[model samples]
Target chain A: MSLAPDEVRNIAHLARLAIGDEDVPAHADNLSRILELVDQMQQVDTKGVEPMAHPLEGGQRLRPDEVIEEDQREAFQKLAPQTEVGLYLVPKVIE
Target chain B: MFEHTVAELSRLLADGEVTSEALTREYLDRIERLDSRFNSFVTVTGEPALEAARAADAERRAGRAGPLTGIPMAHKDIFCTRGVRTACGSKMLDSFVSPYDAGVVERLQSAGMVMLGKLNMDEFAMGSSNETSFYGPVANPWDEKAIPGGSSGGSAAALAARLTPAATGTDTGGSIRQPAAMCGVTGIKPTYGRVSRWGMVAFASSLDQGGPMARTAEDCAILLGAMAGFDERDSTSVQREVPDYTVGLGQSLEGLRIGLPREYFAEGLDDAVARVIDEAVAEYKRLGAEIKEISLPNTHLAVPAYYVVAPAEASSNLSRFDGVRYGHRCEDPQDLEDLYKRSRGEGFGDEVKRRIMIGTYALSAGYFDAYYLKAQQIRRLIADDFARAFEEVDVIMGPTAPNVAFDRGEKKDDPVAMYLSDIYTLSVNLAGLPGMSVPAGFKGDRPVGLQIIGNYFDEGRLLNVAHQFQQATDWHTRAPENIA
Candidate 1:
């Protein structure tokens, strides 16, 4: 029911969030309490109960295979942090 | 004008007694003067609202105005508004201006409703209190020291303060109903897909639903008619016809079977709030409703189940907020990983970061079954409990929150304590049923909301029930003193 500091660090990494060394203890404490709260669910007998994903009872609706959306590269790219030549700019991945 | 309801204003506009431009100006001026104390609005569209109001007046001159034409309203900051800043009450989106209008905004605009501005909310629609908002907490109009329940806190407070006659809100586990109750207003969260979520920012996509908040159920009914419908853009949008919510407002509640879940009345409920709920039930009985004691045995598991499920979904949805595309970006990055991490870390508030971490841990390898899967299975049990209760009753009634609004920072340090405030309201969201909160009475100076829960897509009946109660009671009519 408790999260260790290393575990919190791992979670932050997996979530792609940067947490400073000072904030880890607070996060570990909060996450631990939340886990303890959610830990109450373990007491219930859910042996054969199905896991509910979507609330409604139906599969996703599939649209016909046709191009319907107009290209708005310029309009959408206007809101991006960084972009160049119709591509979102980011730290270089290639060596 | 400040005391008038949306229905009343609509009538005035229809009668040619007042122009939409003048009405819009009065509301904008009131918000400018009074909203500093409440911090309800994030952005005020003064110039654009005037233009829209002028257009509405032109439409009326052309003899082509609908019931809601020329009525001024505000949207929760979560909805995307073209050319307007839609912050979603987060530092991450503080500067983000959307390129297109949300489905709800588009519908309301087409109905001839003028937009006043966007209201504030908890960051990414998380948190029970409005304190988590980067823009600052919304003050409860009834008691300026207390918190307005959130993430629809701004909408509720704005209505309570008479700053706006109508405002849109979203509910992901009691966001709409709780705030409405705390602020002593009326709000409804329609069936999960009753209103389209095409451009509404996703927090927990499965549970997040948009609805209307106003001073009276009749007003909510009017706004709901314009806001609810199917949109192909949202895969989860329900395809059923949206009945005229206003038409059923006059339906008699005679012989209505009302259920009171035993669990909801037990344990942590405040005694004063319980008294208010009891009085409300008696009023319903006088209206010829038959009250029955029902058992939703899995009620206690809602908070735990929600913590796991909502955060798990939010973690996946919010991953799109990296530095590369849109949202906040860090100063410098040695690598792509650093960019994403620092940008997200600096952009998100403490509560948001906490949820992402919890979600990451829950969905991480090796722990998925014990946490995520178990939570989902429990969610089924919770929903099944409601299904059984609804079989014996037409609607369920209870307190919207455990207690009235608490002072800001009272439960801020303890997340579980804050989560428990929503215990009585969360189960309805889990079941994807329509739920509403109406001003039942007051606890001392603060307000108490009586929650009404209905079966799937039963929004019309729910609105009727709230509307009938509003007809008999003056609680919904009472506003905070000095608000004008």
Candidate 2:
């Protein structure tokens, strides 16, 4: 179950990484080796074994829905790379 | 005084043998003399430390000081400390000053421990060695040429160099223990949910655990006492009562069944590491502990499983950093896509970006079942292996790493080799169990660690065992003569 170079390139694209064409072979090789290592999982009979998302099992712990404190957006936003008043600045999404 | 444990310092402070100001000054002076070489601290807060010291003195004068009062400690940069620049070791959060305190920071402050500064770590706590830190690598106190094991490398180095009596560290995959082992210090990653993760910058949610790093197991136990508790803020915070970790330190180890996993010693282990761990087990036998060989057949799958699960979680957790409400944003965005791309590309390091991509791919729609689902099942088998072993033994022991701390660039180019260094440590996190590293002996000039694996919330026993070992051996007490 080795990963193909194109598969690695596709995964890289999905991950939003700008991998160069030259680096594709190395990344493909590494990813394929990792996938090969993971191939060992197929030998285990996990058909009846339920997938464990987290180690602990219980109802989701929730806090009070109501706000217990005031907003610190003004102060926090000052640390952001770009912000204006309360709005976070980004490149315009639409024309 | 510089070599004294946190427990010793606290006692002297309470008895008026030393003032908080003097203690702070001593530590500050040591940090000043040594930090240049160690590179342990990213930001050393002089004004804040002195102010807290004075307040600690006043608190003592008012007879309101707790055990940790007036004692100095530092935080790993991952904790969002109020008014402090809590950079999670990336250029992204380099200028970000946290508006609020992490739950651990708040709790430690309540205990009256003075904040020294923020220690260095792997960028976003992603790497095993602290080299990935944006600020630079933290040097091992034992030998400046060698790395202090990381992502809590700075904390471990600082403690070893006597920069601070103790410091806080987070372990995802042996981050705390590896560095502790390399620097010849003691640190423990408590059972998951033992310490609140609120205000902690999430790396891998299921694996990230905050714990104590210090000069001794006793110091670690005391710090853990203050750090572990229920917090409504952290959803994963356990509702179980926090035990006094120091209560059973004096308990005997007679009749204790110590399990040595056969798989851990099977292959790829260095001779020096194997020898030191064998010596540690012999000492345990001398302490009346019964030793037996156990098998965790699923151990090899841990690293691969962790790579999948951790990256998947990291990819999701880091999605919040997309030119967001705080942290690095693109200078000028031609479009929203450009903003995200440049911001992330510019902000994160090569390794962090690599992990994010790996995680993103693993969790992508078509591959999710084959990659993420399969990893989760393997994660269960890894955990179940521990469950079966624990039923037969009180605790497990193994070499913390396959080899001693390597040269700076030894495994940097080889990501697989670097990943394999964590083979022994990853299974513990996969199983969500508690583990600690105590200084066993040296491999050449570099220090080796004897890892003790405990059942859930068995921190007290683990600490006691390490403490007992420290008492019997001087390895924990030995410091590099060149330091300070």
TM-score of chain B of each: 0.99, 0.99
Indicate the residue-level lDDT of B439 in model 1.
98
lDDT of each: 0.94, 0.88
Give a tens-digit lDDT track for model 2, residues B418-464: 88889899989988899999999998889999999999988889999
Every candidate's fraction of true contacts kept comes to 0.92, 0.53
Which lDDT tens digits does candidate 1 get at residues B114-209? Answer: 999999899998988899999999999999999999989999999999999999999999999999999999999999999999999999988999
Q: Please, what are the lDDT tens digits per residue for candidate 1 over residues A1-95? A: 88899989989999999999999998889899999999999999999999998789799999999999999989999989889899999898899
lDDT, residue B113, model 2: 90
How many steric clashes between backbone atoms does each model show? 0, 0
Instruction: Using TM-score, give the best candidate's number.
Output: 1
Off by over 4 Å in 1: none
- Fraction of true A-B contacts recovered by candidate 2: 0.53
Candidate 2, which CAPRI tier? medium
Error of 1 at B333 (Å): 1.1
* Two-chain DockQ for each candidate model: 0.91, 0.59
